[model samples]
Target chain A: MKIKSLTMILLAGTLAACSGTEEKPVDQNTPLPEVETVEDEAITAIPDDVDDGNAIDGGSDDLSFLEILDDPTSPLSNTTVYFGFDQHDVSGEYAPTLDAHAAFLMEHADLQVVLEGYADERGTPEYNLALGEKRAIAVRDYLQVLGVSANQIEMVSYGEENPVAEGHNEAAWAQNRRVKLAYSGR
Target chain B: MIRVNVFFILVVLCGFNAAVVKADLTFVVTDYVEDAIPIAVVPFQWKGKGQLPGDMAKVIDSDLSRSGQFKSMSRNKMSSKPHSPSDVQFAQWKRQGMDYLVIGSITPKEASRYSIRFYLYDVIKKTQVAAYTLPIHRRVFRKAAHRISDIIYQKITGEKGAFDTRIAYVTVEKRKKRRLYRLKIADSDGHNPKTMITKSNSILSPAWSPKGDKIAYVSFETRRPRIYIQEVATGKRTRLPSFKGINSAPSWSPDGRKLAVVLSYGKNPDIYIYDLRSRKFKRITRHYGIDTEPTWTPDGKSIVFTSDRGGSPQIYEVAATGGRAKRVSFEGSYNARPRVSPDSRKIVMVHRDRGSKKFQISVLDRETRSTLVLTSGALDESPSFSPNGRMIIYSTAGTRSRNILAAVSIDGLVHQRLAVQRGSVREPAWSPFSRR
Candidate 1:
């Protein structure tokens, strides 16, 4: 029963997926500069008291912003950013994925998230702790560049203590080195 | 809420709950010096009935053998057993090419007390070099055995022994989908495991105070890392104020007056000395880069730490009161988390050779400015000096992907592993010599 509950907790994110967002980049592989103007409607979400009641299309055919994040295929569902060994810089490939989260966090001004960072089992935990924070900050800086509020984000590092994959191989390590976005109050 | 459980996989051991004795850890001597001193520690005679509380002589023998300096003779190989110097079998032991022989007896005393007596003889010289009778309660018979080993070790080697000391380490286990972390203390030989603290989150950097009475470590109880000083005996802990950012890699000063803590006030982590009595913190370094893993010198003069101010991560020396830092390690691109020797002349640290992915334990002689890589593991880290500065106990990957604690003599001639049945052990901190 306990095992089932923990699995359920982990899969909660994926199960929240349902449909697509309103302002997703037309070309998922488009350059990051073009991705900036993709969220032009985010101006309406700037106010602190913004609510989900202002759906762009309350029509029977349209999905809400939260519903788009709930969609498994939506870019907002890609909350984790993977990194190379000992490297903390966010690469170009993660632009679209992070851009989508940045848009959602801006729309829901009340939502807060903890960016939990981690490292593989190669280096010392102390250095890895520092490295983990750097990775999380990399993700946070990207969000801030897209105009996400500082109060809407928090950061924590687990270093090499917690593992989503329990192995010493490259495949497992590739999964361990990550900065995950944990949304509060789903 | 979307909370991805990000974690690094470590150690695979199949040690499920099973029937066992008190000792949760055991020693397996992997490499022994080919020409170690031939010593015979005969099984001490037990006078009381219903079996002795513990095997006193065996503990002493294991302690000696673990040092990699003595090669103990097996009990079965001995022709006869003697309890005192009067049983002169010096000729027989010399025939077996034994240089030293230790004999002892455990006799019941009044009110649950036991009179433990031991005799150490130089078999080559045919003379009894040392003998002592310890009046110890049966409850402390195991500790008495370690005390006996210390006595014999000091008499022959002329160096203070660390057999009576303890080691603090952190172990993590996967309970279904949850990770359980534990802070454990054990005998120097990795026996009699005792848990000082346990939590569901990560616990990093368990460092022993100079006096060995208490320890400071990092725990993530509130889902954020913070430092806590814990009393080993009482389990009482006081958490340092939760700063804005990371508070970790705590090292107690030599005099046990202050602590060197790595604190990041939402900026780069820097070393700060937190005074215990005044509860005031003084920033020790002003740098825009990472400055952490600060360890004080035995003389309490300078604090050596790992920093990347120069470029790559390397060991640097700075004044305890704050000053311009000088680099200490130059042999490798990666050198951090240095633990100084008892003599204050040598430092053991984790080193990654140039153009290499593996991290091994290496010793740097500050006077000569030379480095010697010890263990040849793919990833050997958390190098801690034994109290006598003869051995280094560190964490290394074990067989089947399990991370276990291993010890190597300073010269790298002898090696041993503290085998655990389950859980991945890391960040092992060998305690200072005990006052007892």
Candidate 2:
């Protein structure tokens, strides 16, 4: 099963890379495939509930947020949330994962997470830094609205530096324009 | 590939052997003027020397050719090497299609000084235009060549030459999983390069003071961006206030008393004046949007900066003391990293063309209200004007996926690329004219 999943991921990567270079004309009739694929991946990755055998159910909370977030097989394992070019608004697609994080933070008073926002290497350095900060702050605000404490979140913006992918193309840029949720205490 | 790598390593190692290692950047003219006047710079005759103090003639030749105003004849193409006008056959030069001729001779004097004599002749008019004899120290021999070029350039073009200047640039090298960033300063002709500061983290936005004695740059050595001023001669650095959020985009005021920096300790990234004398921070812009890359006007009365309050990044101007900001660039949807010209009439930035994906350098004329694209690149940034306001040096992606430095004439007539053998060069700041 693992080998099969790896093969599928490699296939998807190849097709996406080729399509990115060819830049096939999009038809108004057909839906955007990449966005749909991204949404499907995000949806299938997360679990409906955080209930697990390791959860300390004797307490008021029935499930452990940190355990679910740390579990590789869980949907909450995906720590990075991507954004559009020059955009700071969080899309509704990340709602489930953000909800899981908010619940976890609220349950554990000592838990803290750092939202490191980054922008693609497109605009000026200083302005991109501002945009990055805004993206992290936007994520922080959403988490706060979902019941996460303000003190639990710390924001930092790397701007266009420290890109995960190095190419000057859209695929690389998409991977770079993101905010990574780095949780403390392992 | 193996052979090329070996050769590159050897070149870099040789450059690293000197006491003060120099990484010279040679220029390849990518564009030129159509009606460039032809000129010949004869190799200077060196007496009682194993080698001349420096290649004075070659320096002058490169400077003139890089300007796009003149085409220098190669030494191999010249029929004779003349040290003075007495040995010059004007008719021979005219036959070779050269309009002007320059000849010089170098002689060592007492106490490590050199006496130099040079003459510029107008071949078309068949008369000597100017001649000079000066004694200079051995350490300043390269500068002497630039001075000669300056004299010739001013006589011919009736404009001050910017040959005798320095350029401060940033270089980044990826070493395995780590990146090394170095702030390098070099002669304007791309010689005698010395690394001013090297850090394990990132460094950006180097701004040379008006006096050229200090440089202000942003360093992420502490894991957060902080502005620091480093004296050029002594290599002394003083860290400014870090504040809460971002501290970046440091631009020195005209008189060097203040630095316009973008700090986000407040609600948003806004321009703030950090007075050097009093060491106080005075807010300049109060907008909630991002205001960055502030450059002072020549007269020091106003500052032009990049702001996104208009929905997209655009150049805007505000009073130095503080007032309502006015938009300066209207045509482009993405214009940022503004650098005002020495004349205070034009501003340049990394402009993203409307409806296009590529980023390029562009200039805006305040008086004419017209913008001209000066470069064609996938990414061109940090457009800084020369001290004379004639040429602009910027950073662009060159071959091999490396960011190399480039210079373009204000009219976009002449273009030269300054490509290093390794790493990436960026954030070039041309120094003001030296007092000497």
Candidate 3:
């Protein structure tokens, strides 16, 4: 049985490596298949509790909060939060999304997330790195005030090194100054 | 009518006589429109050396040639090689159309030590213009050549020369997998490069202090870039107050008692002053936009920095105490890296011409409000004035992959290129006047 399991792991590694040619070199040394399997099991078990528990009676029967989160048409899945240039202070307009994300974090205590901060490409590279860090810290502080555990979140600052928009115009600058939240672990 | 006719004829006759006498005694004033001095540097004779010293004559020849004030004759055209002014045949040099000649001899003084005596002779005057003997180690033959150039320049132009000075630059070289950045100190002609700091991170913005004993540069060693002052002679380094956020762009005050830098430990990037005597950092500018690249005026009374607070990057001057800043550059859309002249009456900066899409060195006369363009090269940055404030050393690149050091006079007449074998030589900070 152990030999069979080892063969399955090797097959999974081969499939992951074949996904992207640029990422194949990094995948060869990383144990990504094992981590993926654990994540898959956790995601599959979350829906079973939502189907039979208070989530069914807490809202419309057919359109539960969990159902809205999973549906692509729902506003919760399409929400995008904006931050000020070189600032992480949740603007008054973004407070509603912050409250929603805070409720989501409270409902799923086991979910670990990472907040990545970025800056526009105006200042020096060194100064921008520190600015991005402060932006991420500001967002993390707001989330913590909303009762998210500090241990469940990680912060990283990419500075001006990476940009979502490549243009040097004002529209691109506004879009590049942002913090992105991504689920990292179960 | 008859009297008027007589008067006109008399005047014409007198004017004709005067013209004839003036034509006969006319003296051609060649000195008023003289060209650059044409010189020939003969190879030095070794007196007491086991292995003859390096070609000191070639070093001196290149040094003088790069000044754009002398035309060096080819060695093959020389009629004879001389060791001193006495050995030089002035008629032979004059026949070759050379105006001046330089002769020298090297003798071994002791172990690894040598003495060089050289003489500069004017062929036209048939006399020795200057003579000097330099005692130095064998490895310093190039330096001896630089000192000779300085002596000859002072004798010719009545101004202190910059050949003997040194420049501190940041060198970036790639190793196997990582890029190695170093702060290097070398002669102004790019010789004897000594790596002061070698790390895997990027190092930028090297500024020499007033005394030329220490240098301030920004290094990314702690994963975040910070400023550090290092003594060039002793390699002793001290980190400045990094505060809580970002600290960089350190420019030393003329008095050397304080450093003007940009700190964003506050919410926005602003200019700050750090007192070296009291070890206290004070915020100087409270702005929402970026205020960086601080440079002190020669008198230490004011500071000039680049800021986008005016809706674009422009040069602004603020009092050392720091309240309100007045806009100094109104012509260029992008004018950064403002280096005030030693005389404190002008500023040399990198000015971007938006229409032509070129960045060149420009001089701004604070008194006249006039701007003069200095270079036609594309992508010219980092304009640093020589100690005399007559010339500027900047970095420019062509189709080549790396940037090269270029010098241009303030009047836009003298232009020359410094030859450095290394690729990508940038951010040249000219040292202050050397006491030695």
Candidate 4:
């Protein structure tokens, strides 16, 4: 175990340098030029009620905007987004709900939400944990694309440990494999 | 009269379950080899002042039977209780269709110490094959019995016995609305069980130190998974620094100086080694795909882990220090949680059979690269090999679906299940040979 530690130190430095250079090309190729246009469009597209930042008199207060989360009929009420087995893709079915959440986060900068990813009790625990994280990160990326600040989104994964349904059937598994959009400090 | 009185009390306390005696736990061989060697272990005569520290003969019988190597003769059929070769009951045992006989006596010597004399006899040859007198502590009398079984087993099978080792496992129980998780350690025969930690959260992936004095396990008490190493005897634990993401799947090096763990503080779950002496952490695998469940090779030169870099999860091996990983499994679409045998000649993992769509424990020969499925359960996983590499203990969930711990011989000849009435037990990690 000791014989290779010295070489490993050098390898890590080289790998870090390699990753640093790889990111530069992608940042220069895309996303930089459109950042201004996307932000301006997102600001103009905000709802009239949330456009006003006043909290008192039932205006665009942080609490008033959060009321959208509590409304049963609102798209923000859909806290869970289900995924196929071993998949992290955000399907089209959840696009509207996620878009609602992205718009809400853009409207309320103080609102911080945690995306807790989970998997069913099937694969190995460690692998499931990675899969769960992948699901959360995929949602995080989608929110980022919608102009939601990355700092407002916290990602966590419970893997298959915290199952909502205890049954081993497909119905229970489907319910358990999901990403829960848990809002805090509401 | 005294022996009869004590025996009666034990029988009643055991609820008339003749198959089990009053030990912390008892093992029943659910299956065994068809032509196992039959042997008779006479109840050890107690010439001491008080009752014998433990039923030594019963332990030996259970240890040997659990090994899938011997079929112990029922004690009720014994024609005589012999304490030494001079008792001369070989002819009677041979007539009972037994190949060997064991006899012993426990006599007190000094304060908290006793002299245990035992002899192994070849009934068919009518000769005593092995005999020894061991001075044992009253507290470790059961361990002495295991050591005696080990000696006798080595004499009979020419392979060192792992009966004196230990196993660490996690048990989960639902109480009201909360689930209780406990990290526990017990003897190889499921005796002297000690719970190291109990919490409302979860504990998983327990790895024993090379010396069997410390254990490394992942605890979710802090709300996120983090690795902790605790001294088994002292119960003192040191939780490693939690990174931004997961800090799980800890495995100890053969020299006990470092641990190979899976850390996802980066963008992906990767392998890292934490130095115990220097308190330094080094990254081993750098991949975008999932890389976890790191296990050290027997030589400690390389670590075999589960990686999905090639698309799906499979076993891979890389140097103990950071390096490129080489794929190790190819027969299955899914194989993960790889554990190497004591000799590093075989690897066991949770294998998903493509045809049946069932997950079972599968063994792969490192040399031959041939895969053999060792279990039939729908969900069999967390396989750990015995110190002697003769048996594997794993967790299995059946159709009715309550997870439990089970052990099978490497050859799949014998099988046994270990569980309590309630609670689910999983992740059985066989400890190395006992230091004492």
Measured against the true two-chain complex, the DockQ scores of the candidates, in the order shown, are 0.10, 0.11, 0.03, 0.11
lDDT of 4 at B165: 93
Clashes within 3 Å, all models in order: 10, 2, 0, 1
Highest-lDDT candidate: 2
* Candidate 1 off by > 4 Å: A1-64, B1-21
- Say which candidate scores most in DockQ: 4
Native-referenced Cα lDDT, model 1? 0.79
The better-scoring model by TM-score among 2 and 4 is: 4
**What DockQ does model 2 achieve?**
0.11
- Residue B158's lDDT within candidate 3 is 81
Error of 1 at A67 (Å): 3.8
Tens-digit lDDT track of model 3 for A152-174: 56555556544677565568878
Best by TM-score: 4
In model 4, which runs have C-alpha deviations exceeding 4 angstroms?
A1-64, B1-26, B398-400
Pick the winner on lDDT between candidates 2 and 4. 2
Task: Write candidate 1's Cα lDDT for B1-436 as tens digits.
Answer: 1122222111111221232135656777777777778999988888888655666777888888877778789889999888867886889999999999999888898899998888999999988889899999866666788889999999999998889989999887879888788999988866668999889988989999888999999988766778889999899988865454588999999999999998765456778888888676677776766788899999988899998777678999988887678898999888988989999999999998899888899999999989999989988999999899999999999877778999988888777877786988888999888886
CAPRI-style class, candidate 2: incorrect
lDDT of 4 by residue, B223-324 (tens): 667788999999999887555457789999999999998877525787878888766667787777789999999999999999888888899998886666
> Residue B321 in model 3: shift from native, Å?
2.8
User: What tens digits encode model 3's per-residue C-alpha lDDT throughout B207-254?
Assistant: 898889999987766544568899999999988755333567789999
